[model samples]
Target: MINFNRFFSSLPLLLATLAVQYDEGKTESNAERLLKFGNSLLAQGQLAEALTQFNSAVDNDPKNYMAYYKRATVYLALGKSKAALPDLKMTMKLKPDFTSAFIHHGNILLKIGKMDEAAKDYQEALRQDPNNQEAKTNFESIPALKEHIIDAGQFVKENRLTEAVDYYSRVVMYMPWNVTFRALRAEVYMKEGSYYKAIDDYKSITKLKPDSMAEYLQMSKLHYALGDLEDALSDVRECLKLDQDHKQCLPHYKKLKKLDKQYSQAQEFINGGRYEEAIQKYTKTLDTEPDVPLYKMRSKAKICHCYRKLHKTVEAFKICNEVLEHDEENVDVLLDRGETYLIDEMYDKAIEDFRKADEIENTQRTEEALNRAQKLHKQSLKRDYYKILGVKRNARKKEILKAYRKLAQQWHPDKHEEGPAKDKASKMFMDIAAAKEVLSDPDKRQMFDQGEDPLDPEEQQKRQQWGQPFGGGFNPFGSGGGFKFHFP
Candidate 1:
């Protein structure tokens, strides 16, 4: 009763009819038998065996929509959605009214974020089966999602990345499983200078695509940019696990490992109060990796901080300026430089820096530093040895001696008559001598620079008890506590 040769002659047009006739207990084609076997294997969770049967079924009858659809389902079960895409498309082509095929296709498209195309598939599924709840729910949600995606795109085009991130965030919230939208939002967060948030998204993406090395590599770079060297190293280690010899990852891993060790050693030095050693270590880090701007800024800021701790004002100022040239708002560098200025007795400069730092970030530390600097600056103006000698604060011993000699001779009491004129002359002479005494001695000069006048009555008593000379025991004409100006 079955015309076998006629069925073979009209394979494409009669394949479905032939399979359906087999279902009615007539002569069955090999494809129908294989399709049945594949379904049985699929239901038993034997995806590989089912895949083999489905492949044979498709080979026997290329026009079998059910075979293609079954193969696509097997591929989905095996977590091979990409492999299922072509089979899903073929099923749709052979059976345009297949509601399940359209729903499956739309789901894959939605997962991969082909929003408009996914919407069309859902619409077709709804058209075929108006009562399909899944299709109705998905189709109804697409228009609002599409509008959010469109708004995000427009904001990105206009460089309004904050608004773009906001819309992208909304999309991600609606479709948390959509990696594409999450990645898009991550990129916008990066462009908006939200590196930590970008890293958070990338971390989620790694969960979605655990075998993907690119996401780990990107996360490593973000951590490195944010100066989280240890975190950067950890992410790179994840990348290595995914791909042992990844070109960029291996070298980055090595570099980060080296930096971590070096940085930790530098921190140890800092904690131990070995500031010079810390500075050296920090400088080595900078020299070893000067390519990354953020890394360089961090390293140099630390070096500046070390110099501040060492009371090496010149070196601190040099490194601090280098850091500020790149990052003027760097609060750590500003604080370090302010302290450096305070140590160098540049009170006005210290006050200015402290005020600027407080303006940038109003914190208790900065406010206290500002108050201290202001108080010290006001005290500094009261008694300035440099002003008394009419010389700069950084005047060398030779310059200070020269200025003192000139002023002392000009204001000698013997040169003036007794009484008011002589008393004035005596006071001027004593002040000039005290300035010279402090400025000429390195120890006293250091003490004065630190805001403690060695010539103060209290300080002088301490020094006297310690057997140190008062005012270097100035005896111009050679003996006694009296001043005798020789005609030179």
Candidate 2:
């Protein structure tokens, strides 16, 4: 975490020491001084150090377009295209007539996969700097890509997908910077049911051609097919943001809204100890919206979860395997399958799936599942407390408390009927409470964090003698850990 960039960033004296003297009668502020020095550092190819100076300059004078432009330039050099976006946008807003800024920003956009946005920026650059070679080359390449795309489309319509794919991929390889060409190839990939490759292309296109409703719609559908409901919903929302109320978007928007509601209702039912009802609702939702692959697969996954909770292991395993056959990399289905395996005492099988899930996405939930799977396999009760709270190491007191409270409400036994749901909730409620009690105390937390069990019998006895004892885990502490999270 040591910021080496800080060394050359704020040290104004370094500039003079290096023979980059300030001009006489310069009455500019610290930010202006920093900007000039940062530009010089950039020219010298000291990128990281230059970034630090630019950051300092921005902190001192946020209104300085020159500082933003310089910072954006550094970000571009570092291949951090997204990092450059806000600064480049601010630069454009502050100095619309700066043709070079437009060209540079457009190129950055192109590199980052915002094809449509980059095209617009390049066109603007062309209007202002007609003879600009970079802008002209980029702008002119787009139409040629479009022509190639049309030829590829002819092959697509004739059901000659292999030829279409071959042709498009070749064109994209040649016009590597023409993002649209890659997008066309991605569409062909999707048609061929090469979902993983198509998803990859969709991801790039969405990033590159963000404002284009076509790209968003395509990505949304692909993600939906892949059982990535949240990503699908996100793409839909982004499309809606651009189109407002376009006719093509309204149906998708409405369907997603309904699906979201149905999904939430099913979750509530599950939490309320109505597993059968939840399954019914989930199934109904799936049946009603089979077009949205996201809802269909997720509903199936939830059905598996419900079956597992209901101790219908055979059914749960069956559904999970069936779903996996379609979308093998779905983390949620993998997690559910792993859980079912764990419950069946198939710990190795559980661990294998959980490990794969964790490798795909290093989420807190998956890490705990992985460890807990291995732990039980080894006959241990040692929980990964940090993973339990959905946090990492070095978490502050308030952060621990916040996570604890959120999970407490989420798994409150009172929310469920007196059954397996309640039993599971009761166990987790106690564990979360115990985790909070141990982690909230400074000395106990330090001990726990340093590989010592603070809840051991000897420590418990000492605490009881000191007029304190661990409560039977029943109380619910309450806050949420997610904003855009949805159970798959």
Candidate 3:
């Protein structure tokens, strides 16, 4: 009561001392409080909220190993095993002597059937605690887990693909970390004709052993069989990266790259209407090494198409004939060649080709083509000058002249006696002369190529007005008194 100020100051010091004692003995820090809350929430099955608290605990103390492990537990409870993997890894890194973390890690690996990896973790946990019952129990099962692998191999040897696949699948499920089991399962899948499934297994094997070139080559072959050329090419390129001079890989890579490039370019040219360039690219594609039969047929068919588009009927026929020699029932090439013949006004050959194509595949396109060819053939018989001269549409002027001279001598009315034979010869001679007149003259030939007949009554009137001679300067019965020609 006498010194009140001094007593008050002494009271403050006493309170401060009490606060320090409580903090050191019973009171918890903010991080410890959050970790305790997280554990309580985890015990109550409130995983999302427990995860938040654990995250705060880790943030408060970056080196807190327990907080990381708790967060991993929360992740596992949430069915996010992959997400928990990093946290478990970090917990082991921070506190290597934490046997519980090792046990939990081993349990997770065991659930995935990675028995060998789980065994290693269990061994590490045993090393740490020397008395982990969970680690010991799991470690004891690894030998039994490996027995399934032996069974898988036996089934494979017996050629029982279905049973082999089942056994290998069991082994893989129990030993997912084992590359040999995965590869064995993949082989079984291949033998079962489950090619897509085999590819999936090989994809995992390549990831586990990136240096294994054979797995990559196998993947490339599967992709190729599926008609995924780009994917096949990509896998083969990965093989080349592992070993540039690899015997099987190098040749395959070259062939795939060449065919892919050539076919891609040819398609581009065709789309752009560049028939000449497309023809060149398709020809090059056909010549590429390790020749695939389908590829050769495809390239030849495309070449025929390009030539036809360019109105080069002879070239189109040559390429189409090559394809027919191998695949006679190829309706597409038949249609292409038939169209080419139609363009050259070779009606009989066009009709033959179209009818054969229709018989092979009676699609609307083929039926329509057959009908059109039939109709055109009937009309072409009326004024087919090439047929009358007995020369090809692409024959040279010399061939035309030779054919005309031979026919004129054989069918001349003067050569026959004055009887019914002479009457028939007169008619034949007039028809042959008209055929030569149209075919030998370039202007009239151009007109005929445009589907017009210069010797027709209406066309002859036009020729007269244009001062064009109907005989085309060839008079077989003129002053020479025999077959005579004025053309040079």
Candidate 4:
């Protein structure tokens, strides 16, 4: 009966102890459950939710190494690589030989562009567990990094530049020490027409390797395309500084210099309204690069226009003629010369030039010249008909007609109004009628062709007096009614 009280008291104490142990076990299980949930979320890319679960697990068991490691992974997933650093270090301290933790820590350092620290972490991971695949892969990846870079180069060549950029970005992210990735990415950026992005990448490359001409040329070309001519000029000059006779860069440098000067002069001339003088300046620009066909053609056209405005037709014609002599098929010069000929009223010459001009295909000036020449030729023919008609040396056809009509009407004096002028008019009229008849006849027209003037009264009288009677001896309308005038 004395041992019952001691037994009861011990029973209660034992029950309490068991309850406390059970509670401790429950707490640890709940913490493990939270950690597992967090890891699942992380693997599924639900980083924020995983972070919440990881934070709960860490709160439940502050010393849980896996919780720390999982929380660090979530941080990395969330792009908070710096935030993951201390958690990784804590994970390593909690479990020193944790191979996966070493890999995660190194990877976080790598994400933050810290290659040396990341390499150390990877090495330590490999040493702790020599057969760890993740550690081995990360370690082996460093030496084969350039091969990855060359793969990216091949991607660029294939014009899979977006994918190439991804590969290059990976190299840049994993091996921040090697700048070739950045440089390669810059080149791809240029190909993609992302000039500003290329400039930024090129700037990084220049910082890494100061003596690279390729970077400078890329930057210059980009600047030029963007119309930042001054910056383009600066970059080209810097490129030349790297290699004085760099063949690729020399042409660009020369082009930029020429463009700069032309832009300045053009602005100046436009503001001054000195168009003719400006044209002259532009003409002089062709001297810098005469082999450029566009420059020569433009200069010739402008100079020709200046001559035209100054009313210097001959000068314009001369220049166009010279150009045509060299390039007979040059449509612009041919059209221009045709117009000049029309302006000079050389209508036949203008028509010929215009016909040649029209034979040139598909030009505005050719059409214009053709139309102008046709119009002027029609007008010229109408204005100057005398050259085609061939009238006489000096005789008035009206005076010749009047004298012949009076002689024919008076020879029959019964129809004539008469006085002392009547007999004279009749005899003179007969001679005049014979003269007019001979001149008008076609056979006498042949006689006139032999240099005889049939309109001369004296020649007509000689022919009448010498005319022979061929069929019969008969009196005709002559000086006497019984006397016949005959000639051999």
TM-score versus the correct structure, for each prediction: 0.55, 0.41, 0.52, 0.34
Model 2, position 176: C-alpha lDDT score = 53
In candidate 2, stretches whose alpha carbon ends up further than 4 angstroms from where it belongs are: 1-9, 12-14, 22-39, 43-158, 290-488
Per residue, candidate 3 scores C-alpha lDDT tens digits across 204-258 of 8877665878988999988876667899999999999999999999998988998
Q: After superposition, how far is residue 125 of candidate 1 from its true place, in Å?
A: 7.0
lDDT of 4 by residue, 177-221 (tens): 356667778878878888899898886676656687888888898
RMSD of 1: 15.1
Model 1 lDDT tens row, 174-211:
57767888899999888988999999999989877767
Collision count of model 2: 7
The alpha-carbon RMSD values of the candidates against the true structure, listed in the order shown, are: 15.1, 20.3, 14.2, 25.3
Candidate 2: residue 386 lDDT (0-100): 70
Between candidates 2 and 4, name the one with more favorable lDDT.
Answer: 2
Ranking by TM-score: 1, 3, 2, 4
Backbone clashes (count) for model 1: 0
For all candidates in order, the CA lDDT equals 0.84, 0.77, 0.82, 0.68
**In model 2, what lDDT does residue 306 have?**
92
Ranking of all candidate structures by their lDDT, best first: 1, 3, 2, 4
